[model samples]
Target chain A: MDAVAAEWWKLRSVRSTYWTLSAAAAVFVFVLLLAFQMAHIWDGLSVERRADFTLRPLQELGGWAAALCLAVLGVLSVTSEYRSGMIRTTLTVVPRRGRVLAAKAAVVGTVALVAGEAVSIGSFLGTRLVVGDRPFPDQGASIAHDLPDFAIVGASVAVFALLGMSLGVLLRSTAGALVSVVFLWHVLPLLVFQLPEPWNERVGSVMPGALPGQIAGRSADSSIYGDLLPPGAAAAVMLAYALVPLMLAGFALSRRDA
Target chain B: MCGGPSRTTVDRMIEVRELTKRYGATTAVDRLSFTVRPGTVTGFLGPNGAGKTTSMRILLGLDAATSGEALVNGGGYAALRRPMREVGALLDAGAVHGGRRAFDHLGWLARSNGIGARRVAEVLEQVGLAGVARKRVGGFSLGMRQRLGIAAALLGDPGVLMFDEPVNGLDPDGVRWIRELMRSLAADGRTVLVSSHLMTEMELTADRLIIIGRGRLIADTSVRELADRFRRGVLVRTPRPAALTAVLAAAGGSVESMPGGALTVTGMDVAVIGDRAAARGIPLYEVTPHSASLEEAYMELTAGSTEFGAVAS
Candidate 1:
């Protein structure tokens, strides 16, 4: 309990925590606002069609925006500590490596989850104001969608931040951790999607992105990916990617001399 | 020897037994043992890379010991239920969040082990950091940061305090302040362990000294004893050197004849030598007492075992 309190105090005391979360919130709302404007866009389309347009698509965009929020939160939670060299001090105080890591993941994960839910619900309600009495997207077709569950968002952000923690500990360089996180969490997932055949598609299908799609649901015109496994499985894989390194780093910290 | 690390009582603090640390094939601290008693300033003296820092880190549980043990209150540092209140240490002055304010940094540390925010302010004042309590530590100079580190260590008002290279980059005034601070802390009946390569500073500040070289213990004794063991004989220069030598040698004093017609007298009282020269009709040009310092004595002691070799004199 004391360790958790200490970790929370440390988390709240830093400007970087608030700054990164605010930036994420601003980006999220801004992107959703843009999504709204796009839904109601009247520049090119016919006047009749423009008036007939629905705001349901903005809801899908909201999930993407939330993912971006997690990325920022995840990076800041771990990378900021590495940059300032506070990790050593933190480890010195706590001494329990696994507990420290768990406390950090819990705090950052909770914050990210709350923020993600706000983006989901805020964009869902806010976008509804611009488009009224519209038919929603298909329920079954958007196989991997996440429906703004605080649990899902919390899990996703927790995993991402955990991976960042491992990278910070292993590399001991903020720049290197940041680059590797950006590459491994975001770019690698994208590259996996590009691989030829069913294997590439299979791997990309279960990546971190797999969860958000389930909540957003598919638009009426989209093809059904109903064959895909549930978001829970993909979420598990994403978590595994984060947990393995975290475990390795914790063991190494205990065994090695600082 | 127990299932977990132990915590020693404040009155009977640390016992380090054969503590060793190595990085791969290169040993940083080798089979070193020393006890730091309560209510005394024990100086940890060694040149750079002689394992002073490594030994401190091992004691703090920041580094795993290669072999042996360092017990605080008769237990390992990490095993203590409340380490901060038992043993407070400052290994690095700059181990703080750059973006966070100083008080906030201390606040979190205070919150740990059930300490309060009010104690943080008190500690800040104790270290002369009250004026900059709200300032971001990133903007603080090295000296200010050192003060802040001291504040962190003093926050819990622990029994045993360990400072590694406390006066490294401090200016002369800062150094003096630290010496006085250390003395004051020890005066309050706290165990203060200070490490430094500056032997002269340690000479005046420390009550007892533990000297290390090549990651091993060299000498652990009182400052007075160290200077006494390595004290050179009384130096005397005289025009009638033969007369002084004959007179001093007649009194059972070993005499070394130096150039410039000077005579060095050993194993005899200096005042007696002066009186003997006067009585023997010897006209003495000069007779001076040569007081040996801890730095000079340390140089003589560790001349052979300095692992990385001494810096050019």
Candidate 2:
């Protein structure tokens, strides 16, 4: 419990925490504006072009940017200490290194959950506000869609934040961890899509790029791009990305000298 | 070892036995053994790269020992229920986030140890940083950072305190302040181990000195004893050198002629030599006594063990 409080204090005391969270929230609002602008332009397009306009993925876009922000926040949680040489002080205060990591994980995960839910839900509601009145061709397919997708966006972000924690702990360098997260989340999927035929579908589906559709429990309306894991399977896979690295980080942290 | 409050009493002592730490093939610390008892500041003296910091890190549980144990109180530092409340260490003053305010840095450390916020304020005030508590640490000077580090160490009011070069990069006033702080902490019956590569820093402060060289213990004795053991001899200069030398030799004082016509005499006090010289009717020009300092002793002790030495061509 003391560890938790200390971690909380550590997370909130830094300027980067507020800066990154605010930037993520700003991105959410900007993406909402962009989504609404696209929705407004849907009426002027021809039938073929109109069919291509899908608003569901627009809600997920804001979450994507927010995940990037949270990932940076998570990486900084540990890497900042290393950069500042605060790890020695921290470890000195709490000799059980594992407990310190656990507390950091909890704090980052909690902040990510709260901030993620707020930004994602706000994006969804804002999109609804702009596009709700003007009905598209195939609207209102399921009434239950809004809340679940909203919740999923928040969960996906929180998971990414946890993944950042593990990477930060493992790398112990800010630029190194941040680059690794970028490679895993963005660059890996781009390379995966370049693979030949069904292999692209097979690999890209499990990558973080397919997370939005997998987490939303449905494919995007624009294109049937690849073979995606089922919702439960996708959730498990996403959870693995966070949990596996976290476990490894905890083990290394306990065994390795500070 | 038996465990309980009785064990706790024993645990309050910092004991490092056969502690060895090796990095790859290079042994940083080899079979180092020592105990820091309460009520006095034990100066951990050594030249640079003498394994002083490595041993202290092991004691703080920041680094794992390859073989042997470093215990605070009676158990390992990790096994302590409230480590900060039992042992406080200022290993590196730079181990603080610059973006955070000074108060927040110590405040978080305080919270980690379950110490009250009021204690944080008290320590900041104690370290003379209370006025700048809200200021960002990025703007703080190195001396200020040191004070903040000391404040953090004192937050828990621990029984055992360890400082690695606590006086480094400090002004004369700051150095005196830390000296006084260490003395007072020891006076309160708390165990204190302060490490410094500079022997002069420890000479005035430490009661007992643990001098190491090349990761090996050289001497563990009182500060005064070290000075006595390494005393160079009294140097005497006289206008009537031959007569003075003859009288000093007759009086059982070994004398060696130094450059520029001064005689270095040992095994006799300056007063006795003066009395004898007066009795012999020898004209005394200059009589100066040279006492070997802790710095000289330390240099002599670690002369061969220095990792890097300037070669005189």
Candidate 3:
């Protein structure tokens, strides 16, 4: 745990991570406003429904933010080390490569969760002020409020970040890991959904992005992910996706040289 | 028996014994063994592809040996709880994060090792990189990058240190500074093992040398002892080769003729060569002691035994 705390300090001390999180915040706010503007285009029943209605759209926006910010957070967190050859330096300080990998994984996930949640809440509130309380529920009654959505999406962001981190660790090269996770987490899942019906249903449940959607709940397109996985199932899948690379990387770390 | 030097001094002796590394059919290191003691610079000497880098990597736990082991503070580098505090090594100056600022790069290493954040600044200054500490490492010249690497190695202030080819690309002044740095580090009772191909450079820096060729130990000796035992004969040049030759013949000395009216004299000292020349009134142009350079002697000794000669490397 001391090693883990040390790893955390190293991660947070870097400027690249702050810039990446800031980018995510800026993008999340921009997209939240865009989602709020789109809410006006849809025909709704009542002002009350409209106020309550923004929750879904905001949730969706937050989910997408969680999903995409991973591309930045995950790649930058681990692959940036590779790009700078800082991983070797990191390994030198903590030669138990397994412990180092775990420390990095834990650090990346926890930071992403916190950063992702902060960015989501800031963007949600900033956009709420711009979009008006009348339409998006300044009522502040339901857990569907910005705070809960922030928690859920924060978890989703953490999942994606860990997923990306796992891929980064599995593939030591920067370009290779980034390209692989982008394809596996983003492109491959899209390609998999377009496949034959049962295949899409089956594969979507296990894909990395599926974890985020399961946590946030699927849209009308829920069928696209084989009868929307329960939050528990999604969490399990997320843990699985994150842990496989971690374990493989750990084994490789121990078996092979640093 | 190979407890090495870590036991005696404040330094943790890095002991590599019977360490062998192989890649498929190619045997890279063959039962190589040596001890790097603290309080003196131990030079890891070898020609190109002589497995100096491989051996260092194995010792640092960056690469696994095919057999045997390397111990840092009585355990493998990977087993150490605080590896940087136990063993700090720079296998290559180029093995660094070029995109990171020098201070940030070293800072991360410091953080991981549980060292104080202040050590980063101190080490950066120690390596003369305080001015460029915030600059991107990619922009540094090879010498500056070497300094950054040294800074990283020194971040934890560990007792054991290893560097391979640390002077690969440096101005003469930078090279001299590194030599002095190694000596000073050793003077502080830290175990410092440095590797270089240049014997002259090692001659100035290393208190003792571990010379290897073809992944095998050639000699583990000191500079003066090497010079004495190698027995490279004295050189006596003369403007009158025939006169010197006859004088050598009468004096029970052997003189070998050279193409440029020179004589390679054996079985005599420079003073004797000078006295003989003076007595015969033969003008002596040069009477220099031509001790075989450790590099040349090393080459001659390993001439038939190198693993990387006459092969496309």
TM-score winner: 2
User: Candidate 3, residues B1-313: lDDT per residue as tens digits?
Assistant: 1134445552468788898999898787889988888879999887777888888877777788899877776668777777777677886677665656787777767777778878888988888999998898878999998898888888778888898888888999899989999999888878899988778789999989898887889899988888877765666677778878998878988778767777788788889989878888999888777778777777776686666555421
Tell me the docking grade of candidate 2: high
Model 1, runs deviating above 4 Å: A42-57, A134-155, A214-227, A238-242, B1-12, B278-286, B307-313
iRMSD per model?
1.6, 0.7, 2.5
lDDT, each prediction: 0.73, 0.85, 0.74
Candidate 1 per-residue lDDT, tens place, B188-255, comes to: 77889999888998988999999998789999999988877877788898878877777788789999
Residues A1-258 of candidate 1: C-alpha lDDT, one tens digit per residue:
777788788888878678767765685567556755664553456766756554445554554455555655566666676676566667666767677777776776667667666665566555554434433332222322333443354445556666766777677666787788777656877677677777665665666655445433322123112215555565566667677887887787666655
Q: Candidate 1 at A119: error in angstroms?
A: 2.0
TM-score of every candidate's chain A:
0.76, 0.92, 0.78
TM-score of each: 0.89, 0.93, 0.86
- Write down the C-alpha DockQ for each prediction: 0.61, 0.82, 0.47
Return the top candidate by lDDT: 2
Model 2 lDDT tens row, A144-222: 5566777777877888898988999999999999999888867887787789988888887788657656766776435
Candidates 2 and 3 compared by DockQ, better number: 2
Sliding window of 10 residues with minimal summed lDDT for model 2 chain B? B1-10
> Which scores better on DockQ, 1 or 2?
2
